[model samples]
Target: MHMKFIGLLLAATLLLRCQPSSSVDPITTGPEPEPYRIVRDSIKTGTYLGIAIDEQAASVYPKIQALQATKGVSALNVVSNVFADLIALKERLPLYQYILLDQKSGTDSGVQITVEGKTVKSIYLNSGQQLTQWPEKQAVDSSVRVGDAISTLYDKLVAIRNIDRYTNKFEYISLMTKNLSADYDGGMSQSPQWYFGFSTGPNQMDQIQVHFRGGKVSKLYIDHYSKY
Candidate 1:
């Protein structure tokens, strides 16, 4: 009886040992990584990249008119800064890019922004000046919509301007559609094709068309009054 009992105990001990000992080994994996451009606060986030792209092919008409009246060097369109002085951009010039400044000529419409020395930003204008072209809300198409129309307009505008000297850019035939038309109000600049004139006053329309197709905006137009 004692021998039988010992054998049974040994069997039970072996069975217990054979059972999978899983108290679940603790996982040592680390947490997942963060995204490229995530911003916690909705209001504090930036669209700097979007703004920069938009500025690439933007129209200087609205700002130029404002500057034309003031005859000032800088405005919503034209910006001049020192080669290294980013602090001078007092107010964040939203949707503007650096235009390479020309070392020699004080003004070269050929170049958007330029300075004798190198600029911290990619774009530059002549004489260390910079210009950021905002969308001509007035210039947007009223009929067709969808896709990236504003950027399209901006692309076409810059392509043309870049192809020719600054003088030619003012005259370069715009590929953009004149799908929507506003009667020439006449505060127009003497510059070529820039015939339409508008008040240098604040843009009253909540949103202006940036790009157009089939008589409508190509990209989503932000209705500043309403969240898009």
Candidate 2:
């Protein structure tokens, strides 16, 4: 009976050893959280133009106090020395543009002005998109060339999407001229525009559209499946 009991105990131990283990490998879970998703909440809040008046721009174009004299506008958006002459012919200019919305009257009005070295070169009142208010057409120079503009746009995207670390997650699809015309203004015009396209994946379902005009970003659009 003692031998039989010992044999039974040995058989039980073997059975236990043969049973499959429940422990799982720690590496089986999917890759670490995507870094871009960290800023997902901010991205969903509103449209991000990624426009900021930098130190150089601010130094060249100081804030205008007269804008507050207007009925509703209490402040102005001052952007200085944002663009440079490709030929290095002239100093960079500052841009004064502000938007004012009156909730009581449901009225909206704004002003856009371009200042060249302390002199107002152009002014547009109540203009939308500010396309019509772009400074007098100048030849596209190497200083603020298309390539430079593209780089700036890319940097802005990296900041806005918070994907600077995961830049590999995006693929630059193409940079094509949307409105390539030398006669844009009846003569050689500087307002040439291009559309830059980028996709988050090879599927090309999600895309980022960057519209560049006059060597500066004019508009930004994000096309994602979630939006639809």
Candidate 3:
């Protein structure tokens, strides 16, 4: 009887230790957790836009870094930023069509988040008075992944940047379009090769060219940036 009781005690102790910290314990069993799910149908769209005030604007990057630094968002302060109030950021998975805000209008700038996957397809800054437009509707095809789509888009955007008013040797610069064109006013610069912003400016020399691979862009060789 003593041996049997000792064996039972050890088994019970092991089982108790294995008991999950949370009652819901979706990770161990039960329905999927709020913030974690396997998105089916292949394509889902989610956009998070935030506008920051003066000091807050610069804090945006730091906030993101801090939140990530914690390894996990166990604490709230590590999660909240002037631009984003990620209070309930957890307990919820990436859903389609969502907007998060700290305070709409401010002195500094706002942020836009459009990610098909881990890859950022679009990012924008909101200047005061300027309206941030979230497309009411967007088309998402079954691309292998967001990275592939961005690679495709980057290639196309680069090609578009190649054609310049200056001497053309066919060079291109790869860029983060959403960030660079956040203001949308756009600009152009030249030295080794020409670079153009949003609105296609008049070419000083060769006709600007944009290469496309089907609906998605493939490869680009801008004259200035593209060593290609």
Candidate 4:
């Protein structure tokens, strides 16, 4: 009986030894990197496309006239000569009900400006479109204009760490490619590190997205928001 008991005890001890340990090593990993920033507040005041928020239509007309002459391949037939004419006449005559800058023609890509009391109210620049032959200046910073290269934009802006925070490294590397073929059509630069802000409404924020098309900045414009 004693010998049998000893054998059973040894077998039980072996079984226990074969079981996994109840205590486990904690998983070890590095801290997650910070996410890419985005402009959170509305931007109310700034100059865009050479026009200020409250600038009179008459004061900005001459500049518009000049810009009309420089219409690029994207803007042709989109904004008719009547646009300049209406602005010219609307200064003295009430020929139109309201002045709205919209791109009904073309690829439905362009800047849309809303005017109230003959003053520019809101502006939304779509990176999907390029309207003028000459690059338009950013309202906040004229030094940073549309149609520039992504490399150029990085050089002009302040030091911004973790540019790929919003996107993975592989995707960011693809965007930084030079003059990507037209067959490769889509690109975006939404890292708040790259955007400029504007005050659009109370508690609302706006941003100028430095959008890229074919590896060049196609447009830079304030996204006027109404959110409070």
Per-residue accuracy of model 3 over 63-122 as CA lDDT, tens digit each: 323432332211111001121223222222122111122123221222233434334444
**Please, what is the whole-model Cα lDDT of each candidate in the order they appear?**
0.24, 0.23, 0.22, 0.27
lDDT of 1 by residue, 63-145 (tens): 33343344321212111122322233222222222222222323333333211112212222223333243112223332111
Candidate 3 matches the true fold with a TM-score of 0.18
Ranking by lDDT: 4, 1, 2, 3
Best by TM-score: 3
Q: Estimate each model's TM-score.
A: 0.16, 0.17, 0.18, 0.17
What is the C-alpha lDDT profile of model 4 across 1-228, one tens digit per residue? 222222222233222321111111111133432222233333335665564544443343343334433421011010111222222332222111111222233122233232223333333333334232212432323222333333333322221112333112111111111111112111122211122223333443343433333333344454443322
Backbone Cα, N, C clashes tallied per candidate: 36, 4, 15, 11
lDDT tens digits, residues 107-220, model 2? 112222323222333333222233332222522331112122322322322342243432322221111111111112111113232111222343222223333344434454
Report lDDT (Cα) of residue 5, candidate 2.
Answer: 25
Misplaced by over 4 Å in model 1 are: 1-110, 113-127, 130-207, 215-220, 223-228
User: What is the lDDT for 63 in model 4?
Assistant: 38
Worst 10 residues of 4 by lDDT: 72-81
Looking at candidate 1, the ten consecutive residues that score lowest on lDDT are: 19-28
lDDT for predicted candidate 2 compared with the true structure: 0.23
